[model samples]
Target: MSTADSLAKVIATLDWDGDLGPASLAVDEAEQLRSRLGDGATRWVAGAVEQSLTALHGQIHDSLAPWPIIRTFTRHVLTATLLRLADQDRLPVDTGAIDRDLAEDIVARGIPLSDITQALRSMQREWLSLLIDAALGVRPDGIGVVPALATSVTGTMDAWIGAATDAIVEERRRVYLAEQVRIRSAIELLVTAEPVDVEAVTQLLRIPLIGWHLSCAIGVPPGGTVERRVLDGLVHLFARVVGSERMLRYETSAGTVHLWVTTDRPARTPRVEDLRVPAPLLVGIGEPHPGPDGFRRTFLEASDALRLAGSLGDNGGVSYGDAALAIVLSRDEERARWFVEHELRDLATDSPEMADLRNTLRTFFDTRMRIAPAAERLFLHRNTLINRLDRIQAVLGHGVAERPAETQAALVLAELFTRRPEDPSTGRHEFGA
Candidate 1:
């Protein structure tokens, strides 16, 4: 055969479906050479590639680091290249479908595009080495065959790389654009509080419309910028924990993330501790409710809880519904402050002596003013407890025995407002020692 026809024969072999191993074609000289020499070479090369996958996995360590996928890609590409050489006829090696799928997967995994490029290049090198080995082992006299084989391998790989690179880049771009649209639409639909197409919001955000939903308000301390990578990691982790993609998130300009997570069963709502949120960032979870209106309500409650946590010097998560009374009272800061200051008067100031006195008063009321029980609870002698109560009466200019209910209510207010030290300007920020 002419060199052109020989190359054509090699390429056409790829399109041939019948087995061409030596056992299947011993009688025919041409079939025997192509089988033992061509298909056999490809099989030997594929085995070598399979053995090298573990080492390759170590080199390309990332989200797309599964060895089986790498192994398959390697075997498929090498087999196609070798078959082309055996038939010597042009056969299309269309790996675009697989490339597009891999690209989409890589993008979803948040892996860098460079990793894909590096992985493909690594495959080329490994395949080339095996092809050389196969050539030496099967066709010792065919030095001319080696060059033709090498040319075919390189050409096929380059085509695969170019097509895959384009597909990966385009897929990554599309994913990012879609995320932006979803976030923008979610933010608008939530903030406006107008009745929107719930189905549209659900489809856009990929979250459920009718189910138990808990909103979480996540934010860093003032003056801190939200790290996108950290936030993305948090979102991904949260979704994984819930075992669902039915979650929506929107990040505010002030470095706060408003998130909604839904589950069909109310009992399955994720708890604050389960989230394992890290510092300088606080998370506030809302009560779980059903449907779109529930989502909105829970979001508002979560926002309130976030503010309440900040106010209480709580640098962690707070459940809004659990602390409803305090949260409601905290809304009127001036009134709450005034109520605490006027009601407690000189008794609520920050000092060890005052704290002791306040504790004694609290203990006395908790025991229903029973002197012995109050003293026992304080781990004090009755006379000592009486002396503390006397001190409290002296500070207030009235005895606890006079209108105890009013005093108890006043003490409750004091506990809420003055439990932590007030910063004078920023209200409570630090706890009194």
Candidate 2:
């Protein structure tokens, strides 16, 4: 018989299902390795991944494949490689689904094709080493079949690589189209004032709309750029801070990311300091409210807060509560600007002296117009505090306490709308500095 017929006859005679051939021996050796490792299949696959990664360490840069994904892929490849060795004809290994999944992961993670190919080649080497060693020990003339067995392994790997590459391309296309659809759906659900079918919107967005929602908006300043990985990291951090897992996100082309954390109970506000937000990225969070309307309301609130942060030119988290009054006043920015300029007159000018006076005035209001307390808080002598108050009154030509409500509103608008030079020390723009 020819070599092809001889190889086919040998494969047919082998009891692939029984615990007796080279396949069984290779499996047993792998199991023994697993036993020696003492952490079950995870550790076994991790060993293979380590070897593969080590082989491609300097060859590829910026590998985004997570460890869990690598471990799962390694396990699948190991199983499929051994199975393909024993049953070339009746290859029961249906790795098509897993191959597609792996392809999607690779595309999502930005893992290079070469990295995957190199890893597969490394696995093939390991599998061949184990199987050939077993075959030589079990069969009398196993050396003669080595060439055919090697050929089979190579063919299997080549087919897998081809399939994976095709799947990767398809996944990339799917991801782009899916993103476009999601963006359109999100805009309809969140941006429009018109009512929507809540159930349909929820199903389309894959998020529940019938729970308490705490919304947040995160974005970089204009002319700044952020990566998707950075945004995803921020989302994970925010989820941890809020202690919620049910999160829904909508990312825009402008690099703004809006998300909501939902719960059965009322969501509590997260501590801003605990966020430890990085520089150049601002976060705005809204108060928790219930139901679908609350979801949209909180999203708008968060967006308003984000705008407040941007206007302040500060790279930090801002809660809706922090900017609530300003947001209300700035709704009609033209009128708000007029009110501020009219109320403060020359004090609204971007000047250091005016900023100091505003700070004192804000502190005085915070202390409920108590001179002693305000003076103490400002670390000023009682007479010095009174003198500054007198100066502030001079600028407005009225007593600071005369129109408390209107004065406070104007102060908030001025603080938000006034353009000041950047403070190098704090990396923020002061009210009027």
Candidate 3:
């Protein structure tokens, strides 16, 4: 039997079928073994018995899939096996101390069981050396072609051919796998935006919150510089943890926060949309959809939200959708946008019935607060009003209702943002559908 075969039998001594911890230990042993093998050979061997390693890894790593880990380990094992053969002088001479040092470090850090075992078939550089010594060139029973191979020039040539075959097979296997990684990566990029597109933008954009495995909530704070520092640190860490193109942008206000991240593709360009936002520490609900108008261009919308986050932590920020904000953005760039940002966001626009939310909101301003009355006047039930409010609440999030004043102010801002002149020529922007 080959060394891999012997090891497989030895593995049965560990009872890998039992508990997870023991299985992990078995995996660790496998890793230690591969630490001595070569990376490529390891990969090929793992491929040969992929099913076995899969089962072992599932029993070992438990949470992290055993497949990727085993595959990775297999590569390492092949590398180690190659280095060992070089050491044995059966192959061209090369350094092995570097590998020995690396193995030592891995051992010091306590290598995971997941790092052990798989397709690394224990194919050492001395494959010919061992075969020549044990089975092929010499056999205790008959010495059939053994003695001839050990002595004749043709025998040496044949041995070399076998060695050449092993090396060629490994090289071809590597080429095939490299092509696979490239093709697989391209398909993955089409599905996942981070690595394929606009990944660079997230580097500049900031994220104020993140959690382990997509959980973005920050735990409630007790309030102090310590808490502030901790929370701020968490925010920065969250941004850093996300670290790249997988991130989103956000805007906030006295009553809400909106996200403005775009999608990753060039042709399928993602418009800036609301990102998650809330006071760094305050606990309350915020709207889910884009909030009321604060005239903002795409880039400006994103930038302002990030900037606004620094100044208006307690205030809800960035309430309007890109459509609503885009209107003012086209005309008086700074003034209208600034007014909405600073002065007028919380005035009052008449709230219409839930059904009328799609219509021009400016018409409702005459009532001081038309949302409830309009719903009633429209013969809509109180539940209907609540639902309309709920829809608005879900869209903009519920954070803005900190008090009546904030709610009223947001209402007025909505009206002002929507106000348009009767004559199409009054404002420089040529009004058209």
Clashing residue pairs in all predictions, respectively, total: 17, 0, 61
Sorted by TM-score, highest first, which candidate order results?
A: 2, 1, 3
lDDT of each: 0.64, 0.68, 0.33
Q: How high a TM-score does candidate 3 get?
A: 0.24
Task: Give TM per candidate.
Answer: 0.53, 0.59, 0.24
Least accurate stretch of 10 residues (summed lDDT) in model 3? 424-433
| Candidate number achieving the greatest lDDT relative to the actual structure | 2
Misplaced by over 4 Å in model 2 are 1-187, 419-433
Q: Compose the digit string of candidate 3's lDDT tens values, residues 171-276.
A: 4465556755654443233223223333322222332111111212222222312244554554454444333333332222222222222222211222112223
Judging by TM-score against the true structure, name the best candidate: 2
Q: In terms of lDDT, which candidate is stronger, 1 or 3?
A: 1
lDDT agreement of model 3 with the native: 0.33
How do these models rank on lDDT, best leading? 2, 1, 3
Off by over 4 Å in 1: 1-168, 223-245, 268-277, 361-375, 381-433
What is the alpha-carbon lDDT for the whole of candidate 1? 0.64
**Stretches of candidate 3 exceeding 4 Å from the true structure:** 1-119, 122-316, 321-334, 337-433
